[model samples]
Target: MLKMKPVTRQKVNIVIDILMFVVMAALAVIGFLIRYTLISGEARWEKFGSNIEMTLFGLDRHQWGFIHLVLGVMLAVLLVLHIVFHWKQIICLFRRLTPLRPQRYALVSAITVVSLLILISPFFLKVELGESIRGQGERGGRNVSRTSGAYLPSESEDRTPLSSEVLNELPQTQAIHQNQNRRHGEARMLEIKGYHTIGTLAKNYNVSAAKLKNTLNIPSDVSSNERLGRIRRIYGFSMREVEECILALQHSTGDQTQHNNSQ
Candidate 1:
């Protein structure tokens, strides 16, 4: 068997330590980038405008998330290697901490079991849904429904225009494009969220509310004012499917426009 020299082993340990540190730092930085800078679409719209698209280094949040995941995998692998390399030292330390043979083995087994449970906990964790999308009511975004806590918008407020307050809150660049409402002559896609109501989506995306309901298979009895998230919970449909349907509707609209121009 090929055995590493003492010097070679020391150098390998140093390399491993350095790589682990670098990977950990990178992981933290990317995690912050995803959480704050490249925030969720819903957050972006609330902070900026629905028209605004946030990106860092030309990569969207999802792309950054992929890189973040890769970094996490690398960190986990490096951690395993680090533990393997220092296994003898670990055993010695445990022996000093718990001198009894049976106790030492029990301590080690308990720690190993705890570490594994912690690692796998995320997969088994339950995800919770939040309140459905509510409309901006005339009473200053207050007065939610008694049953659902959702603000029922009147016909005039149903297609609520971007309020001046919201406009003022936008960044200077976003403020400039607020009125233009054009994205490189292409239709913009809004990020679908549970809080979004069918009416709000239809009005914002320039699709008919009836068509939107039909596409999503939301029954006529289900109010358009009800939040998409609530509807999904009741009907059992993925948000991805909703987004795809919206995109398809936009594409069909664009195709019709092109056909008309060609005639």
Candidate 2:
């Protein structure tokens, strides 16, 4: 390989050092914001909506993560280059170390422990489980349902609007959309009905299981057979939100049926 001139190599090293430092600083701030804001809000909002703008410096969490990943990879590459650049110095320093002894063994052990920690910290510190996306709720501006066909928000954020087709839906959707609570005996829980799953809930109410997933932000990979209690716990949102969305859809389907019958 053609050797780089000493002057050119030094300049490259300085530039890499600056880039690495800047990237680390940016990652620090982004990581902090993610920990405090995005991490907290994600669980709550996941069901409400996706593509929520968890912004810092005009970038959302997903965008920031992608950038972070790129920078991290770049930093790793730069580090390799840095080590190669310092190879001569490193060799001389090692050469100067006296005959390998107990002290040398101790030094190697210390370095190994430190390296292990540096590599392991991230795995334990991550917010989400496994490789799945997390954090979802009404916290970030997510009034609109994922299935706009099922539900649409009114011009006012306070009230949700029904699609024209939903006019045929049961009156329940309208009342609840206005933030009115459900009726006294609209019980749909484990107490009234033993262990309801998303599948049964959708089936009983005549709602779309697929759209319910979209509205509630249930990850596609999860089985419809997954119990509502489990869903509530895993998704980290109130059961109330899930119930309301289902009721609304049910009412819509009912109203459409009523309309058809009338015609």
Candidate 3:
């Protein structure tokens, strides 16, 4: 093979810096899309309440998170290489900023602390804002429970959260959770084996969809294709209780129809 052009140290550093810029820029764009597009509902698919299964760039958010981590490691390595290339200039700049003296150590320490605080400020800001909006805020750590969908469990029903053993014992209950990763628009509520969405169940039982949404505390904007088991889990209600409620209304409707027909 013909000998290629001789590589130089300066050229290598320049190439690494360029690659770093590209990686950082790409990460910035992806981070913005993940934080804003996903939260702002501009993403192609609706998120399932903190579930990371929504798609972007042909990959789910969980997959994207892994990619982001790998890119982050690459960026860090490039940064270290850049520092190695510029070690002399960095030493000179540090000397110019502050001489290595015992009296100057406090000033350097203060600068480092302040710089770190500034770099991490956005995270603290988000936490404060979240607490103000939806967390246990100025109420002295007291959290106000949401007012709507406050279904009190009857004496015969259990309001306590399910134990893992009890949950495992419930037949078919694990099936919905196992298949929770079904893609958007691929959820086939009516055809899914032994699983049903609130809308489909309501329609079959001749009950109002709005009633189902209200009684189950499901969000109104939730798609009709969401499985009933998923909604029950989200709303912290017993699946058996909801199913019984639906069956009761269905039987009552049938009885009324037969009596009216006889009259």
The numbered model that scores best in TM-score is 1
For model 1, residues 201-224, the per-residue Cα lDDT tens digits are: 887777678766776777888899
Give lDDT: candidate 1, residue 257. Answer: 56
lDDT rank order: 1, 2, 3
List candidate 1 stretches off by more than 4 Å: 1-7, 133-263
TM-score for each prediction? Answer: 0.48, 0.38, 0.44
Query: What is the clash count for each candidate, in the order shown?
Result: 1, 15, 0
Local accuracy of candidate 2 as per-residue lDDT tens digits, 1-263 = 99876677789889988988987887787777666665544443433333234566787766777877887888788788888989999767865693566767788789889989998998888675332222223322223333332344445433444543645443443445554322222222211122567788777666788867766778888898987666777786555566566756654665566667888
Model 2 TM-score (2 dp): 0.38
Locate the minimum summed-lDDT window of 10 residues in model 1: 135-144
Provide the overall lDDT of each model, using Cα atoms, as 2-decimal numbers: 0.63, 0.59, 0.53
Candidate 1, residue 149: the lDDT equals: 20
Worst 10 residues of 2 by lDDT: 184-193
lDDT of 1: 0.63
Tens-place lDDT digits, model 3, residues 214-261? 545567888878875566557765443354344334333444455578
Name the lDDT of candidate 2. 0.59
C-alpha lDDT (0 to 100) for residue 159 of candidate 3 = 40
Backbone clashes, candidate 2: 15
